[model samples]
Target: MLGKKKPLIRGESAWHKGWKDLFPESYREVSFPDKLLGDLHRADIFTSCGTTLEFQNSPICLDELRSREAFYPKLVWVLNGKKFKGFKILKHLPDVDDPRLDPYDFCLGEHLSVYRRAELHSGAARPLNFYHPELRNIPFTSYYYSFCWKQPHRVWYEATCPIIVDLGGHFLYQLKQRPQLGESYPYLHMITKKAFVSQYL
Candidate 1:
């Protein structure tokens, strides 16, 4: 079993503090050695329950994020501490047969994920667009959602099951509405907070 883990305190950043406060049992700033995962990588927040949470505030290339999400048993939860963007909980399963070690092939691999057919975890027929001056030349990019594209350095993005979520306020609470169960393949869908409260509350 993993030992008692604590988050690295560079300073009291509110986002970090929020997660640490909410899930005190999770280990913070975790690193997986080379090839143990696909590559040497670090997770901001991880739990023994088989999920890893990635936090985003700055602009990062989507390809990089997509590659990273596949390494977990259930890398659920894209958490945003800021109120502008809410949080999303993804239903994830690694494409690899085993997670404790890399595939014996020791080369690159593709991932497969699916969603709850009822929605909140389904696929998007449209390609979600995102804009950054840096993104102008990038192919297949048509950044959507003007509300989230307010300005640079203030937005966050998470691609769940291939659906893009530009979260808004009360993100943690948004996750309480569990999405419907579906097949396991890569896709992203979101559930309504109201649906969750009515069903589980």
Candidate 2:
């Protein structure tokens, strides 16, 4: 557990106050891996706040904000093995002209602003399913799960599953069935890994 102390403010701008105000309780300046930060930027879901709450990062990309319905705030929580460390808060649509701030920076906001999906997908097709044998103890009508692909560049998807408890049942279950070929999953499909680098690299 992180020590119960205030985080050291680093950035030397007015925004530092905003960061302090956003997370007034407990904060710390822990160094994180740059590669991990890059991944979060690509996913558009990392936040300044450390791991603890669900609204640690934003899930939407800047390019997708043109759509009226795409303006909701999203969170992305990155897990390093079993421990959760880094996060980013994307609150709103960013000003396009600002050179100092990337579109990724403006994605922070309240957690409730984001949408929650119950099914994980690869593009338009569902790529996976989840089953938890311990769902009976959870209070929600559903639970959230994360999905990733074997190949890099493939986008991840998340979905929730309904929880049903029977008397004396001790298991909560979720399934991640792989999507069939030729189906549209949550992310775009392309040529194999070798083919991609051969053409681009």
Candidate that scores best on lDDT: 1
Candidate 2 per-residue lDDT, tens place, 87-137, comes to 221222222223322211111122211111222132332221112222222
lDDT of 2: 0.24
- Which digits, one per residue and each the tens of the lDDT, describe model 1 over residues 1-201? 998755556654555555445554446667876675457777766666545666554455767666766665556444342433332232232222233212112111121222222333344422212232322233331211112112323212344432223354432222221222322222223444344223312
Please state every model's RMSD to the true fold in angstroms: 16.6, 20.5
TM-score of each: 0.39, 0.16
Residue 2 miss distance in model 2 (angstroms): 28
TM-score of 1: 0.39
Cα-based lDDT at residue 187, candidate 1? 24
Backbone collision tally, model 1: 19
lDDT of each: 0.39, 0.24
Off by over 4 Å in 2: 1-11, 21-26, 35-201
